[model samples]
Target chain A: MGRVVSAASAIRLDDVTLGYDRHPAVHHLTGEIAPGALLAVVGPNGAGKSTLLKGLVGTLKPLGGRIDRGALKVREIAYLPQAAALDRSFPIDVFDLVSTGLWRRRGLFGGLSKGDRATVAEAIASVGLSGFERRQIGTLSGGQLQRALFARLALQDAAVILLDEPFAAIDAKTVSDLLELVARWRAETRTVVAVLHDLETVRRAFPETLLLARRQVAWGPTSEALRPERLLEARGMQEAFDDHAPVCAVDHAA
Target chain B: MTPYDALVAPFVEFDFMRRALVGSLALSVGSAPIGVFLMLRRMSLAGDAMAHAILPGAAVGFLVAGLSLPAMTIGGLAAGVAVAVLAGLLTRTSVLKEDAALAAFYLLSLALGVTLVSLKGSNVDLLNVLFGSVLALDDDALFLLAGVSSLTLLTLAALYRSLVLECVDPGFLASVSRSGGPTHFVFLGLVVLNLVAGFQALGTLLSVGIMMLPAASAAFWSARLSGMFVAAIAVGALASLFGLLGSYHTGVPSGPAIVLAAGALYLVSIAFGASAGLVWRLLPARRHRAA
Candidate 1:
């Protein structure tokens, strides 16, 4: 078994192609994300943004190539999937739900210690949901549920964190608050990659950007990646791509 | 009649009544919480499907051993698990979704079971296998019921967190740990085991009724998983007790009596339960001062 690495580790994508059943959703992507890097993945709808996040987190294995997490074990990477994938109607309160973040550390059978309880409470408080600790997750508003999810991420204490559309459809106030939490992760020297939609927010807060549209359009500083022509090219590529295209010849040979 | 004469005297007077009560209460202890999870996972009908899926296996065992306990138990368990695994595989490998695949297989299994049971046995034997004879529980049947109940409780405790995580956010659980798939199968195994336990008392047809009705009623009373577990078990126990008494007094079959008792509670909970009963929904909302 690999020793769990809590310290930050660089994730290297080596000509990675990820897709479903030989149809490439995101392909031929090569990039190295540095430890402590705050990277935003910006792409249009159906541009495989969420797929990229899945690939990074090891949930979706690559169809070709490999994602090399230098020293990070599986548990050392915390992933927050889209809220749509979550079952909000489940009978769980915010505090218990957030405590699930301690899973990697405490594991299946371990009881939560007093300090762990304090940490859970603190995580909830940090998310501005202190008063709603006992509220059932089903009762929470979308923004509040996002906050609770962010709180769970805080408790994960992983070397790397991945968020899929953490702010989509969320209110402005909650977005800023969660962005602050992201900044805190960066300050703590953890790798943070978020799938983002708002170009303005990405340029403002994200130091690095990977602009993708079924393929890498730009991978560099946010300013360079978000350039107008590159953005237009990404949009065009997405619209023009054929879903029924045969397996990639390049991926086949490699 | 006095409450004691009506409720307490049946168990005190008849050995069969006591045995039936003990058998069913034990079955409920194991099965009701499993039903709660099945309900939470929105696989309530899947439980019914699995109950039917076990029938052909039990029928085969009956054919080979003439209603022997171990043979039928093992056969039913094997059949239930096979169906669950096959349905899961079909969902992954084919276009059909999980529920549709399950329904398809269970219907086939049900038809096969009835045909097989009718091959050698009379209609009485067939009805016995279908509706169960709770009042005629032998020592072996009682022991099986207790054993399955104890195992279910222990397994539920051991796997509670993992099972909860699997139910609520399977993707997240998969991302975080490797226990998701195994946990799911274990849960399905427990479901089958409980259904088999239930088969002895409520039989294949009404076994799911004991599991689902209490769980559905519990949903009305509790908003937390732990609370629902308690409520479900309580309802299950009460239904078994009342159903047995009702059977004793009314001459109805004990199996249907137990299930009907659970169904009655479910209906009552729908109207008056604390969580989201119809009365609460219909009542005018209280005006709240601005916080």
Candidate 2:
């Protein structure tokens, strides 16, 4: 049990390879993420973006890699899986759903303290769902449900947060509000990593990016890594668009 | 006859009938909450498997300890837990699915229990064990039913929040665990313990039906967990009382009678429950059109 020093790099994955069964999804990848930075992992469908996020949170163990952290145990990582994976018919109120994040602190056989309740309230407020605590989760719209999930993660009070496709299928206003909240999270100096599909949003909102297509194609600032030629190369369409100059430089810093 | 004479006569005349009614009511109340969780987790069939698995243990206890209720119940509980743990471990470690493992173990236990009873030359008592004879329940059996049901209810109340969380969202629990293994095992153990205790009143053949049908029917009427739990208990208690009366007058088996009552309630729920049931939805449309 190592204590995470304040303001240290949150995650480090070295030569990681992961897949379902024997079919490889992410082949030999290496990356390092710093604290207080929002990194967008962008790729097309079936590009192993979700797999990478799972690997980070220790849900899907990598077949081969040395994944280390700077004194921050993986339990300090909060994850918001895609909303579709949730059972919508579960009979729980919004507050109870958010309160699940406090499960660890309650320990075995311990009840929720006043401090725990306060944190839950703060988490709900942070997600702009203060007065909706008693509402059933089933009745919430897609965006409100997502916010409730985000509130749960906030209650976790983790140093790192990983989200998989948090913006998919959500309305435009919800996308903006969620992005605004992510920016606030960065301002609070927590590490935020999201798997985003909208390239334009990624370019505008995320400062750093990791572009993937079964392998690490580019890693750098979002604007530099998301060049049209690099995107083409990552998609394995280099032969089809060979005439265009490779506009982005691949950084070997990772 | 007056209503008071009819209601009070059943209790004053027969001690065995009084004991049977009281014992079944206690068992039904405790089993309802356990049943609700089992149905929610989609492990309704596991309850069936556990109920049947208790027979061999009960038979072995009877042979060794001379038909002592406590010895038999302890043996049955141990066997039920063993089979549940084995099935769970097999599913995790091997390629077998949980349902397949449960089915395999269920059949094995049933066959072994029958053989064991035959070896002891207690085939008559085997029928008693298979379909409980409420008339044969003694003071000791009644005490055991009351004791076990009370203990199970207390344990369930203590661990209510964690158990419900585990059923509804296991991912949240996993996110907190380093390996996410032991917490899951504890929940599964609780489920096995619940079914084992419930097996005393509801026999192997119909215990699962008693445990699941009430809860499943309750789901049609309520969208909240607390509401479903209350409704399930009400349904279970009513079924137990009605089944006891039916068994007394009609000479039907108590276990099957209770199950039939529960099944009837389930049908009514499907027709008239508030949420998605046929009558609840359809009648409203008709009334609106008429208006």
Best by lDDT: 1
Clashing pairs in 2: none
Worst 10 residues of 1 chain B by lDDT: B167-176
What is the per-residue lDDT of model 1 for residues B1-291, given as tens digits with 9 covering 90 to 100?
999999899899999999999999999999999999999999999999999999999999999998788888888998999999899888868999999999999999999988999998888888888988899999999999999999999999999999988887887787778887778788889999999989889988899998999999999998888889999999999999999999999999999999999999999999998887889988899898897
Interface root mean square deviation per prediction: 1.3, 2.2
Question: What would the per-residue lDDT of candidate 2 be over residues B58-166, giving only the tens digit for each residue?
Answer: 7788778855677777778777777878888998899999889988997898889888888875666776667666566778767776876787677777777767676
lDDT of 1 by residue, A1-254 (tens): 02243456689999998888777888999999998899999988888889998898887899988899887777788988876477889989999989999898889999999999999999999999989989988899999999999999988888899998999899899999999988888878888999999987998899999999999999999999999999989888644457687767776787
The C-alpha stretches of model 1 lying farther than 4 A from their native spots are A1-7, A240-254, B92-94
TM-score (0 to 1) for chain B of model 1: 0.97
Q: Considering just chain B, what TM-score does every model have?
A: 0.97, 0.87
Q: After superposition, how far is residue B130 of candidate 1 from its true place, in Å?
A: 0.5
